[model samples]
Target: MHENEISQIVFDSGLKIHRNLGPGLLESAYEECLFYELSKTGLLIEKQKAMPLVYENVRLDIGYRLDLMVERKVIIDVKSCESLNDVHLAQVLTYLKLSGCRLGLLINFNTKLFKNGYKRILNGDVAL
Candidate 1:
């Protein structure tokens, strides 16, 4: 599927998870709910997917694990922190780069409004 289509699926899944669970939950809680929601929508999803990191032709497996990957087109990172910072965006961007995905969603479940916590990050430097 296209990136936009996969993004919409992720967005809708987040809305459903937030609607049912509200806020203040841990990142793992949101991840579980989101996984179920996405699966119910018939989208192929992967959770806690380990992505190996390559540096100088050596594979580093310890520093990589994607929170969620939807339809193999988007990376989804779940966070339940009090607020999101640049570090959060950067982390998602790094995940996008490592996963070779052009689009990513950084969703913080600790906010009062889910919309305020959802961020769409695109890898401008990488060819999608």
Candidate 2:
């Protein structure tokens, strides 16, 4: 599937999870639930996927990880913070660069409203 399609499923799944569980839970809880919800869609999903960093033509396992990678096209960075900030956006953007993904979802499940807690980040010249 395309990144946008995968992203829509992720948004729907996240909304359902936020509505059912509400907020104040740990990030891992929301991540696991989202993973479970997305799994039902038959889309390939990876949780806590390790990412290697390449510097100066040398590959290094620098402990970078994506919270969830959907269909290997979009990266989902799950967060449960007081608020989503620039750091969060930067993290997702960095992951997109490293993974060569065009889209990413930075979902922070710690707000009174789910919509206020999510952000869509695009890498480079992505169409959507």
Best by TM-score: 2
Off by over 4 Å in 2: none
| Model 1 pairs in collision | none
Q: Best by lDDT, which number?
A: 2
The TM-score of candidate 1 is: 0.92
| Model 2 per-residue lDDT tens digits across residues 26-118 | 999999999999999999999999999999999999899899999889999999988888888889989999999999999999999998988
Model 2's alpha-carbon lDDT is 0.92
**How many clashes show up per model?**
0, 0
After the best TM-score superposition of candidate 1, give how far the Cα of residue 71 lies from its true spot, in angstroms: 1.5
True-vs-predicted CA distance for residue 22, candidate 2, Å: 0.2
lDDT for each residue of candidate 1 in 1-128, tens digit (9 for 90 to 100): 88888878788778878888899887898999988888887878998999988889998998588999988889999999988999999988888788778999899988888899898899876543
> What's the true lDDT of residue 87 in model 2?
86
**TM-score versus the correct structure, for each prediction:** 0.92, 0.97
